[model samples]
Target: MPYSNIILDMKGICKTFPGVVALSNVDFQLKKGEIHTLMGENGAGKSTLIKVLTGVYQIDDGEIVLNGKEIRITSTGEAQKYGISTVYQEVNLCPNLTVAENIYIGREPMKNHSIDWETINKNAEKLLDLRLNLKIDVKKLLSSYSVAIQQLVAIARAVDISKGILILDEPTSSLDSNEVKELFKAMRKLKDEGMSIVFVTHFLDQVYEISDRITVLRNGKFIGTYEAKKLLRIDLISKMVGKEFNNIESIIKKSRDISFKASEVNFVKATKFGKRGTIEPFDIDIKQGEILGFAGLLGSGRTEVAKLIFGIDKADHGTIKIRSKEYSYIYPLKAIKEGFGFCPEDRKVQGIIGELSIRENIILALQSSMGIFKYLPMKKQEEISEKYVELLKIVTPSIEQRIDNLSGGNQQKVILARWLATNPQLLILDEPTRGIDVGAKSEVMKLVAKLASAGMTIIFISSELQEMVRCCDRIFVLRDRMIIRELIGDEIQEKNIMETIAQGGISYGKN
Candidate 1:
């Protein structure tokens, strides 16, 4: 609570990219022996602040004080030298190597000019079991354990390497409830031992549960820092987004002018659609002007179903009909030509082309549908990009700026603009709101609802069950690559969806 107890203090921090001010005179302070969480929406400079502190990026102008002394960290090695270590969401470890080797890697103990196998295994096991309460055979391969376990192993290694300060970035994003509890337990143990931790996560519940202090940042500026218990969740969200929280009802009010109901006409229909080793054969008829959702955990065939429907992955067997026209063969180009657009789950890998300008990225799908023979002129491309930028509220300095210069939320909007340019009858959005901040998520969901109400059919897939409940008109529950049940009307609530997934009940004779 007082500067007297602060172990790490960053003052007047400033980091700038080509056309973006990532962090502008931002300030962050971490108390000794406490868990401090950095909070913000996408592009709010959370990652940039962390990178500057961890030596991934040297600060253009700032002063970093560690242990009451000024320090300049120019590399990861220097950060570690200053007793700062990080464990990212994706565990950066070798799956082929044994846990012991991974923990001590690069600094393994030696015996008579050879590696000391027994001491390494013994110490790794003792450190994990005694320090973190994680009991596992250190001789086993890293891949033998689940993601949760691998995360704990990473923490164990980080603590062993440098326990003064540890940074956990979205560690519980992929873990189950039980695994998250175990992680919290370990974090508490570390904090009790006088280790200060810097946590960065999008999940509010986890932040409030583990953090002693919460720091809010917006538009590359320091908002404030308050004790976790003293900060209300709503107030914290407001600070992060730089606005009061608006409920889903307020977002949908914009589309209230249009009727929000499923029409009798079928937009897309699949009879016994099946993909080998991906998803089971299932019959589905997506009605016009309806939001059909695929709800399930990660790797529950949600993306697979989207892929099959969008012709990204060919269906091994099925009869597909689009607007009552039967199609014996399907592919991406054909799907596009037939008035279908898809926003893929991984925007970085499958969606956005980083080096391309915002204007070029937005016109890609439309140009593809028009074919190279009918290439759009530069003026048309600029007009289309500017139109969507205004329509979708995309924040950009210029349309000619590279898409990579924009933030995560803006990048997602560019992808959505690409699809909207095609004027598709149906849009397949797979995790469209994933990885973005809550504010961006609200914008995307509002856009989805608006489009559906305007007579566009949507097939949505998301891991966030609450999002599916709030946005979907009907939800098809899947488990283990099989369609388990269909939920509609009053049945499309979060509790019911969870129960359905847990019970794995057969519905429509599909499972």
Candidate 2:
């Protein structure tokens, strides 16, 4: 297990923004031919470290050594020149273009002043067959294949172009179990052939499965590095969160005190609510002033149910009633009109408008819900933004500043503030604390509990079993787009929820 060579070494790295010190004196080491994992909670500087190495950011301090020599990467092209390539979660490729064109688009060979289609396709096919062992028509449009295939094509593109380091940033976020295996297969193939890989993901199972080493960071500071086999999973999580990993019972017991079961007239009732070909028909009643949680695997239909409720996806069947207001089909506008607010899973894509100011974004939901003509005064907007900014402790220079400049945690708080401004009867939060620090997650969960106590209904969704057990009064167990079980009372525990998800299937009638 001795590492013969250190292919890349980052020493005393530091990165900072206006109010946030992203990384401080952090050191990362990547061994030649070894798959190294950058482990931490969201905002743990995992992405920052990768960015500094990949020329996405100019380092404030420290040095980068590659292949026993110093190197300065100023841009993506320069990073590629040093044989450092990256494939982010969202593949930076055109779906409308052919697979071959996507693979060699910028680096295509010119034949008589035109792109040589024959050479591009032939080389792409060779790379797919030889290295990835993939058998597919390179001439086909990239969108014709699944996300997993596109992920592989992305990796194939990187592998064909670079020889030094390949960074995969949460590449399996959208892939199913089978697709993840295929990705791991390709990663293993690369590792065996002496390609150093930097993998950043929140999934623990994938960590032990694919990584040779893991470097832990906390609050933008390097904690330690350990071999994959040497570190225990619980200990690793503890290090990342900067807390002990033995408080499940205490957390659940605390959740029990904030109860809504004493008096419930059913806040919202869905009768056979379903989206055809998306989620199966199901019935459930969410109580007033209660935290309802959805528990499942990556594609176990957790997000789908939230979408159906928030009207992001229209339901083909069933009826929904919010506080006795009935609707045959629920969509976002109707849901919002009838007192519903949604914080989507993908914060970057769907939640916040980056170009807008904090003041503008905060009043968006309320403004939209009140109709466009019911304009909020500029003074009123500043007052609301300033109030929530202080309440949620959003780190921003001023309310008029653009939202894109803030950190992930601050941005999440802004979205929460936006929804709270609407004062909706029910809130649906999907992965509300996915990529933030442990402190921010605690704050968000506490806020959810406080809001529910203040008579706001919440449907919480998260992949963390511990968080689900700790926050939810009742959990709906989903699998394959169906609510298999509605867990309450003693069934709401980490062990039970996991077991229910792994051992049970969708077999119950509409509940």
Candidate 3:
């Protein structure tokens, strides 16, 4: 096949923050009518590069060429004028406004020097019609629609400007399989029309499904770009993480096996714990020295279940029992006091306090659990920090080091350390190993097993089926806001989990 025409090119791009090289001598090119995927672990400079390209950040070094001409993008407005637009993971639209208004907020059609609602709606519908496969009411308020629809509206808006490059950053993270298929169809249609798309995501399956070419970045450096069809999934992961993906089963199998010893103690039990239109009420039980895995597809209510259990979101109808005592409307603070700790999925937003030091972050949960007036002694704080620094193998110059300065793996470890310092009897980890390197991933899994073996009950969520099968003593399969199946003992296998998820219902059997 003939090489595609180059649409966008960057040469020797470099960006740096205080004491950190975010991107170093990175080169990238996008071809017309092709979906180019940017692959990397978190903090591998993927976000930095995207920000630089979209004028969110000024590149310290590099030249950008668009359509065979050099261009300098100084601001978001300027970038948009030069035919470049970005749709971030979070939908950047006014929730209270109508879909049509959100799509053409500042660029609405005018009639007699006034906003023209009819013309605006017509134009917005045209754009949506050209891009998306489904029909959306242009007059409906954005918040009334589901997340998938809102995401589609965002993409429709981004592509409406006509001659620009569109960048989609992790757009499918929250979308279900059917929604993802719809998004892919739209993307392929856009590619066929000569639009250059830069797709950024952590889902390996998606990269292979939609990308024409794949570009790998590791620790701020460009590894190489290859045709998507020629790249194996394992090879792609190895390149992005700069190491071979470990055999999770082998690692877990080699570790000392801990038999399940039933006890009268029930760490957590929730009956009908769910919010309307969010997650269905589900009952779960965890015993000491057990790692209970929540297995599900995207938007299958795994995170929602964890959130309800952790009190991040209040359950509208349900009863939760901790150690045989019922909790009525328990919040996070109350949960913490009851020896419950939660590590959220989105680490950057919910997990880390970027402004705090490693010691401060580690001590946060403990401090809260201890109450505000009860300050932790400095010596005690140091002792606790040092212990977890060794236990979780957190890498830092000192406990005094700023949490933001550490690498992604180390930062994740620090988050884990934060909860561990709380001395929780039951810990809930939501996508704990996401966006980290292979070595760090294995370390985190081993830490989880260790914690369980020491009689700390744990509930973990992972999108990787193999991980759930390996690390969890029992797996609860969720689909569309309900637990459909529970696999225990020898039934907890990768094939079983995948088949259950594919079948899209609940099944249960005791070992």
Please give, for residues 1-511, the per-residue lDDT of candidate 2 as tens digits: 5455899989999999888899999999999889999888656888889899889998999899988898888998899999999999898899999999999988999999998999999999999888787889999999999888999999999998887689999898777678889899888888888888999886666788898999998879999999999987657766775655354453355444444442477878888988765677889888888889998755567888889888888888998887878877777888888889999888899999999999999999989888878899999999999999999999988999999999899999999999999888899999999888899999998898788777788999987778888778889988656788888877787656655654555544564
Candidate 2: how large is its RMSD? 5.7
What is the C-alpha lDDT profile of model 3 across 1-511, one tens digit per residue? Answer: 4237897899999999997899999999998888999987656788999998889999999999999999988898888898888999999999999999999998988899899999998888888887776588899999999888999899998898647599999898677678888889998888877788999876556777899999999889999999999987657755754544343243236242556443546677777667665576677777766789998655567888888888889888778888878975588998998898999888889999999999999999999888889999999999999999998888888999989999989999999999998889889999998878899999998888778878888898987666776788788988656788998878886656655654655433211
The worst-scoring run of ten residues by lDDT in candidate 1 lies at: 247-256
lDDT of 1 by residue, 159-273 (tens): 9988489999878766766788999999999888788899987655577788899998887999998999998765775566444424322221233234567799888889888
| Candidate that beats the other on TM-score, 1 or 3, i.e. the better one | 3
My TM-score estimates for the predictions, one after another, are 0.66, 0.74, 0.69
Judge candidate 2 at residue 502 and give its lDDT: 45
Q: Candidate 3: where is the Cα deviation over 4 Å?
A: 1-3, 245-287, 290-309, 313-334, 343-422, 428-454, 458-511
For candidate 2, the lDDT comes to: 0.85
Cα deviation in Å at residue 83, candidate 2? 0.7
| Predicted structure 1: clash tally | 0
